[model samples]
Target: IPTIKLNNGREMPVEGYGCWKINYDRVWSLGSWLFNDDNRAGQVVLQAIRAGYRYIDSAYFYNVEKGVGHALRYAFRTGIVKREDMFIATKIWNNFHRRDRVVEGIRRSLRDMGLDYVDLAIIHWPMGFEDGDDVFPMYWNLSNVPREWSRNGFVETWQGMTDALDMGLAKSIGVSNFNIKQLKVLMDSSKIKPVVNQVECNPYYNQNKMLEFCQQNNIVMTAYSPLRQGYDLLDDPNLRRIARRHNKTAAQVALRWNIQRGVAVIPKSERRRRMNENINVFDFELRDDEMKAIDLLRQMPKLLTFGTTRSHPDYPFHDSY
Candidate 1:
């Protein structure tokens, strides 16, 4: 697997496995209905490791830290991937964005995941939620966050993040779902710049500007939802045609496209076959024309915007970037 060099001298795998939407409720989905593997998330983590994935992406928001931890421990115990070399990335939720609560938040994530340190610790979002025991939103609570809290909270939270890095809680600290403006704030104020920006990016929502900007600024952008879901993006005539040209799935082409652009991808898949296919993007490259054709479909609906929190002062969805 290829590695992307970050600002802090850290090398992250260009392709990572995402551990989101783990299907804890066992809802009637394709994976559960088709495979009947109830602990599909954990099972796939093990499989992903074997399939050549060195990096794993998860977050407190995903609520599957215990399961992810268990799978990782299992892999280590079985002599698959060594704990010291594996790259694990997790994040701090909005509720913990307060400067005072930042350490507490990441500590909880570490405890839940049972990890001593993560390779990367990201600020899940730019917004800061109400100071409370619960991390999830119960109702619209824009007021739960202070009016000037956005910039101030981010600064303070970043200070705590720097502290965590200093203490070796995480090897690298970064942000997710942050736009260029927020990044500018950090660039202006902090001594340690963010190494990566994890965002909703794919062929449909290519995030071309963000990718270029991060590269120019010495920040690597890790892409989540890197694989487009549904038939339109994956099964479209042009993408399908391109996939066939390379003897790859549309999903593989999409993942490869990101790596080709010097961006990292964390694609999620529960099935063993699909997991292998997702990481197999390293074997080929998309033609320039094929890449442009997929980029033309940049209008597909986004996967995770946290719309209910849009009213918050720090909500990042409204930005053009």
Candidate 2:
């Protein structure tokens, strides 16, 4: 697989395996610990590594970092993947939004993942919750918002992330769910530019303008939620036709469309065949007409609407990207 070199000199795989709900049958809320065991998710992480996936995208908010860490070590012990060969990425959650706690959040993620460094660490979102014992403080109470509810707070958090990079905690630092304006603010105030801006992108909503902006700035725009609950992306008539032309599944066509345009995508699954299918996109290329057809798919953008924290002042989607 070819690698895209970030401004910071980090090489990220163009296609990665998303680990949002890897082991579990379905995604549960932050309150899921009361009813289920998350420890089982780690085995699936090991499974992906054994299946030849070199990049794994996860987040502390998913409650699966510890499991992911276990998988990494197991993969190493079994000689499935080396520590240096895999690109591991995780995010800092909104609960630890304070500048003082931003580095601390990455620290927690490293400890949970059982790694000294992450290939890339990102600020999960622009919003910071009221500092408290609750992980999802905003979800628990809508009034729980940070005192600095503007770009200033985001800048402060970005500084802390910069410090993490300097201290060797992460090789690269970036943001998730940030709009064009927020990205500009950070790039202006910080010494290091964000390498990528990950968002909910797929054939349904290709984010043409945002992709152009990131490309112009030399930042990679990563797509998540490429296929959601209904697998509707797998059933789209256009995607189906494209898949038939390539002898690939609709899912592979959707993923390849993003990859062909230089947008990295992380599609998640636990099944071995499904896992390998997500990364088998380098075999074919999408023509200009097919790319245009996929780009013009009716825009029902943003499948992952974080409704619980929608009221926060730093909410990213208020202005369209």
What clash count goes with each model?
0, 0
Model 1, position 314: C-alpha lDDT score: 72
TM-score of each: 0.90, 0.94
TM-score of 1: 0.90
lDDT of each: 0.80, 0.82
By lDDT, who's the top model here?
2
lDDT of each residue in 42-62, candidate 1, tens digit only: 776778888888898988767
lDDT of 2 by residue, 1-321 (tens): 677788777799887778886755435445444444555788788777877778889998777888898888888888877899999999988777777788889999999988999999998888877775466554346454554556547888888888899899999999999988989988999778999999988888788899999999999999888764445667789988988999998888888888888888888888888888877788898889999999888777567767766767887888889
Q: 60 in model 1: Cα distance from truth in Å?
A: 1.1
